[model samples]
Target: MIKTLMGSIREYKRDSFLSPFFVMLEVVMEVLIPLLMAKIIDEGVVKQNMNYIMRMGVILIVLTLCALAFGIISSRFSASASAGFAKNIRKDMFSNIQKFSFSNIDKFSAASLVTRVSTDVVNVQIAYESIIRVAIRCPLLLIFSLVMAMSVNFQLSLIFMAAIPILGIGLFLIISRSQPIFQRVYKVYDRLNNVVRENIRGIRVVKSFVRSEEENRKFQEVSQEIYNDYTKAEKIMAINGPLMQFTVYTCTLLISWFSANLIVSNVMTTGELTSMITYLMQILTSLMILAQIFTMLTIAQASGDRIVEVLGEKSNLNSGTLSIETVPDGSIEFENVSFSYQEDSDKLSLRNINLMIHNGETIGIIGGTGSSKSTLVQLIPRLYDVTSGVLRVGGIDVREYDLSLLRNNVAMVLQKNELFSGTIKENLRWGDENASDSELERVCKLAQAHDFISALPDGYETVIEQGGSNVSGGQKQRLCIARALLKKPKILILDDSTSAVDTKTDAMLRQAFKEEIPDTTKLIIAQRISSVQDADRIIVLDAGGINSFGTHEELLGKSQIYREIVQSQTKGAKVDETE
Candidate 1:
């Protein structure tokens, strides 16, 4: 909680300064108004002096108005400050997430990330705003009221001081007990959120498979666990209020009883006794406020720990310092490369792989489902560091080059093409920010997306839904292709991206590839034989190693796995006839 509070303070430097200044003025109002009340009670009302009452009342009204004005203004400052703090933290988290490798994202589920950004940030925001309410004003009132009470009557001041420590100790013990409970509560909260998010994303699949009851039962179990944990924490903290009230009432009764004796003995006046009682109320009020803030910290601390877990993870891949000016050419090589997700695991994803890709060549890669084809290409950008050997790009070790520069030189359209919610032109411009309509069309033509774009009512201005759910799979693939083409990269990789499109459209897209981006080196990972039939070279992967690497004609002449895949995917006629 302290860490989270400090983060907010650092985030909103301007608002932090302004908020405290206004809050100090507000505290001045709290203290001054109480003193005026005492003045009005004792001097004015006791003497029956109209002028004294009127003057003190007017001053009290002014202080009350100022306090109200300052308090409202300070609260606004807290709202603005807390909002900015959460926003900045969210933005940094987003940027950091973007920098994370696919491996990193896989470690923390999408649902968990959403929870941290949304719910966890909310915790910090509320904690920060509460600082102005309880953190600032409560302590100010506690200490100042003690001073006033002490100055009025030192003997009674001991009672107020004694009450404070009792309240603090009570808070300390409650938080200590509740902290562990809060941690478990937050864990349950994350699990509960995960159930909801998964249910939403997989609703279509769930309905299609008719597993609605099973999913609901799973959700109910998690929800019940969350509720139980929450109730436990709530129950632990709930005792704080009643215990505090009990202490306050008992202490007040004792103070009043003892003070009456002092007043009767002529040691204190009626006005003094009245003011002491009000001060006693203020003390209890501060203690209640303290308890609330203490409880908030316990919960926020749990949330902050969760947030820090994500922010502290070091990226597996580091972006290098290589610039565009330093790019040698479109050439790549892997030497004796071996990789495994676990360091201690003996099994490797890609083993002893030696390969060289030259400029302006279409290299087709094929593999069984777990053949490491995607993982092979993923290494070129150093998404995951090789356990044993080197992967080089543009004649430089990929690790030696800045990640941004290496990525900039390579354009990849994944098997799953995800589009942001934005205009068609905006989506295309992700590859090259300065790309013009003519440039967009040229790439779109190559990707076979030009016709679709032209047919849309808004043309380039047409808005796409999240994940391009509004568009057909093939259309989304083509748009992804166009985006990749817009970069005119040193190396272009399409990882079975055209699988969604029909053979005819695939053929047309291949033809467009020949006209535009003819100089760019291309690596096509395809399932269908026709897609790779015209390639300069085709590589087959099996059991984490290269099974065969040769021209399509050479592969047909020799490789059995390649032949079987082609046979299963195609029937009759010459195997390469479709291409």
Candidate 2:
């Protein structure tokens, strides 16, 4: 995990190194101050020499300023380094997520990934900043203060030995008890984020169903769990403050009592006693800082683990050694292909699927809810590699082609059309970034979207709200279809994309396909028989396997399932006409 996280510190290595170097200098300046004061008290003040006192005081001022300067430089460097490191980490994690296949994405929830990249990264950044500066200064200050105290008066310094062990043991117990609670709290955070995301995205449904009170109750339950765990962890960690104070006071009292007796016996000078007291404060302050650092590190450890998990994930779908670039044609062949979302699972979502599709052929697929219609088409672009057997595109194994090259040649407009917040022109440009205005208009015409788009006041330049909420469902689907048509792909798969459009509009879109792009292989998945009855052929799937495959009329005569679907739809159409 450490190695994986450190890789993100690429360009910040210099700042990371300089922060600690300046921190070391600051500690040295601080450690020398007490010694200078001791000199002024003993050699200058005691001798009644104004000149010597003034000289030593001036040196003290310079040392004080130097320490302040070092502190400021270290802080600036640490801040820059930590912020840059965090930016790189977020960028790396997002980039890695883009490479993940459908199967890889199934391993983590969208909310969990959001938490890991945002909250978890922030925690790691804070810890990193502390590690570079405070972590370095505290240990150096402690060791230097200890040495100076013993040099001033060896016997008196032994008091710290007992205090140090007591503080160490207390801190150990607090950290050990609190760490597990922190780990659990972060997991609950993922759930909390998930709840909020689901609630917001489905706010319309929630309001329609009058489930606002139910959602609020669920949110309160998760929030209370977080509060309870945090309260428990803080209760354990609260022991740290009182324990540190007790140790500091006890050691101060013991040192003061011993110093007075030694002063009376002339075993220690007044200057040395004064310096020893200063060193005592320095030593105790360092211990307090160290305790805070340990607490922060404990929390950050969990966050670091979560971040490493994202960075370390390797996408299972990788292009083979073959550099096959351009697809020869729209032809696709699936030979005894089988797939399961889980690699090791016995259950299969698609089983022994064998089919052949010639270039420019129009195919229709119909099935029950879980028959894997989308799954089958997803394999053509290598969205998820087949669990067994060979799947070929353009007469070549898909894995053998460059992933970008293969996906660019196959366009898929999913059931749920997504439109980002942008001008309509900008959103459509996603299909072809450099597409001209004329090109955009042509594809929209073919998708039956140009008429509505031109009717709008702003036409292509109209701004689409997030998720295209401002547009009707049919409009969104038409815009998505137009966008996919701009790809000019060799094969186009529409996974129930036309379900929102009326029957006449759907028929017009199919007509445009036949006239405008004759050589593109088209696969349409729809529930309505009217959508696929004119296709060159249709597939009926059942229980993860092919139930029947043939032209529309052939299936109506020979397949019971096809006849039932057609008769039911025919009756519904007649009823609509009668009404």
Candidate 3:
């Protein structure tokens, strides 16, 4: 985990190194002040010498200023290094996510990734800043102060030995017990974020169903779980404060009592006693700071592990070394192919699928809910690789082609259409970034989208809300179809994309496809029989296998499923006409 995280500190190594160097200088200067003060009290004030007092006091002022300067420099560098490190990690995680296949994404929830990128990174950043700045200073302060105290008077220094061990044991116990609780709290945070995201995204449905009270109760349950975990961990950690105070005061009293007796017997001087007390404060204060650092590190450890998990995951799909670039035609063939999301699962999502499609042929696919229509098309783009047999595109194995070239040639508008927050032109440009204005209008007209788009106040330049919430469902589908058409791909797969448009509009879109792009292979998945009745070929799927494959009329006459669907739809249309 540590090695994986440290790789992101690519350019910040200099800043990370300089922070501790300045901190060390500041700590050394602070340790010198008390010794110089002891001299001013003993030699100058006792002998009543004005010159000696002025010289030592001037030196003290200069040393104090130097320490302050060093402290400011240390703080600046540490903060810069930590912030830059965090930025790089976020960039790396997002880049990695872009490479993830559908199976890879299935292993983690969207909410968990959001939490890891935002909240978990912040926790680790705070811990890193403290490690670079205070971590370096505290140990140096403690060691230097201890040495100076022993030189001033050895017997008095022994008092700290007893106090140090007791405080160390107390801190160790507190941290060990609280570490597990802190780990549990971050997991609960994932659940809390998931709940909030689901409620916000589905708020319209929630309001329609009058389930606001149920959402609130679910959110409160997760929120309260987080609160309970944090409260328990803090209660365990709270012991550090009182324990540190007791040790500081107890050591101060013992040192004061021992030194006062030594002074009366003429074994120690008053100046040395004053310096010893100052050193005592420095040592105990360092211990207290160390305890706080340990607490922060424990919490950051859990967050660090979560972040490393994302950075370390390797994508399951890889582009093979053979770099066949251009697809010759839209022909596709699946030979005895089978796939399962999980290797150990009992049933495959697609089983023994074998089919061949010629270039520029129009195919229609119909199936029940679990018939794997979407899953079959996804394999063409290598969205998920097949588990068992060979799948070929343009007479070559898809795995042998460059991933980008293969996907660019095969454009897919999935069952759920997504539009980002931008102007309509920007959303459409995702298909071809360098497409001209004329090209944009051309595709929109073919998809039956140009009419509505031109009717809008700003036409192609109109701003769209996130997820295209401002447009009706049918409009959203038409815009998505236009975007895919802009690609001019060799094969265009529409997965129930025309479900929202009316029957007349749907028929017009299909007619437009036939006239505008005769050389492109088109595959349409639909529930309506009329939608597929005119295709060159139709495929009916059942229970993860092909039920039948033939031309529309051949299937209507011979296939039981096709005959039943046509009769039902034709009967329903006639009754509506009679009424």
Candidate 4:
């Protein structure tokens, strides 16, 4: 985990190294100040010599200013290094997520990934900043102060040695008890974020059903879980403050009592005693800082593990070594192909699917809810690798083609027609970044979208809200179809994309496909028989296998399932016409 995280500190290595170096310099200045003060009290003030006192005072001011300068420089470098480290971490995680196949993505939830990228990274950053600066300074300060104290009076310094174990043991107990609680807290945070995301996305449904009170209750439940956890962890960690204070006060009183006796007995000088007290404060303050650092590390250790999990995940799908690039035609063949979302599971989403689709053929796929229509098409673009057997696109194995090259030749417009927040022109350009205005207009016209687009005030330049919420459902589907058409792919798969449009508009879209793009292999998945009745052939799937495959008329005569669907729809259409 440490090695994986450290790789993100690529360009900031210099700043990371310099921060500790400057911190060392700052500590050196601080350690020397107490010694010089001892000299002023003993050699100058005791003898009533103003010149000596003034000389030592000037040196003290110079050391103080140098320490302040080093501190500022260290802080600046550490901040740069930590923030840069965080940026690289987020970038690396997001880039890796984009490469994940469907199965790999199924391993993590959307909310969990969001937490790992955002809140978890922030915790690790805080710990990193402390590691480079405070972690360096605290130990150095503790050791230097201990040595100086012993040099002044050895017996008095032993008091600090005894107090060290008390503080160490206390801190150890607090950290050990609270670390597990922090781990659980962050997991709950994922749930809290998930709740918020679902609430916002389905706000319309929530309001229509009058379930706002229910959502609020759910939010309060998750929020209270986080609050209760933090409260418990804090209660355990709260022991550190009182424990530190007790140790410091006990050591101080012991040192003062011993120093008083030694002074009266003429065993220690007043200057040495004063310097010893200063060193005591420095020593205790370092321990307090050490305690804080340990606490931070405990919290960060859990977050660091979560981040490393994402960075370490390798995508399951990879391009083959064959270096195949160009797809020869729209022809696709699936030979004994079977797939399961879970690798080792007996249940298959698609079972022994064998089919041949020639170039320029139009195929219609209709099935009940769980018949794996979308899953079959997703394999063509290698979105998910088949669990068994060979699936070929354009007479070449999908894995043999470069992932980018294969996906570029196959366009899929899914059931959920998504539109990003941008001008319509910008979203369409996703299909072909360098598409000309004429090319854009032509594709929109073919998809029956040009009329509506031109009717708007902004025409193609109109801004689409996120998820295209501002437009009607049919409009969003048409825009998505236009974008996919701009790809000009050899194979186009529409997974129930035309459900929102009326029968007349749907007919127009199918007609446009028949006339304008004759050579493109088209696969239409729809529930409406009217949508696919005129296709070259249609597929009916049942229970993870093809129940029937033939032209529309052939299926109506030979297949019972096809006859039932057609008769039911015909009756509904007649009733609507009479009404």
State every prediction's TM-score relative to the real structure. Answer: 0.93, 0.98, 0.97, 0.98
Candidate 4 residue pairs that clash? none
> Which tens-of-lDDT digit does each residue in 147-250 have in candidate 4?
99998899999999999988999999999999999999999999999999999999999999999999999999999999999999999988888999999999
Overall lDDT per candidate, in order of appearance = 0.84, 0.93, 0.92, 0.93
In the order shown, the candidates' Cα RMSDs to the true structure are 2.8, 1.2, 1.6, 1.2
Model 1, 413-464: lDDT tens digits are 9877899999999999999999988998988888889998999999999999
- State the local distance difference test value for candidate 2: 0.93
Better of 1 and 2 by lDDT: 2
Give candidate 3 misplaced runs (Cα > 4 Å): none
**Could you tell me which residue pairs clash in candidate 3?**
none
**Candidate 4 residue runs with Cα over 4 Å from true position:** none
lDDT digits (tens) for residues 1-579 of candidate 2: 888999999999999999999999999999999999989988998888899999999999999999999999999999999999999999999999999988788888999999999999999999999999999999899999999998888888899867888899999999999999999999999999999999999999999999999999999999999999999998898888899998889989999999999999999878888899999999999999899899999899989998998898989999778867589999999999998888644889889999999999999999778889988888899989999989998999998998999998999999989999999999999999999999999999999899999999999999999999989999999999889889999999999999999999999999989988889999999999989988899999888889899999899888888888899989999999999
Residues 441-552, candidate 3: write the lDDT tens digits: 9999999999999999999999999889999999999999999999889999999999999999999999999999989999999989878878889999888888889998
* Cα error of candidate 1 at position 43, Å: 3.4
- Stretches of candidate 2 exceeding 4 Å from the true structure: none
Model 2 steric clash total: 0
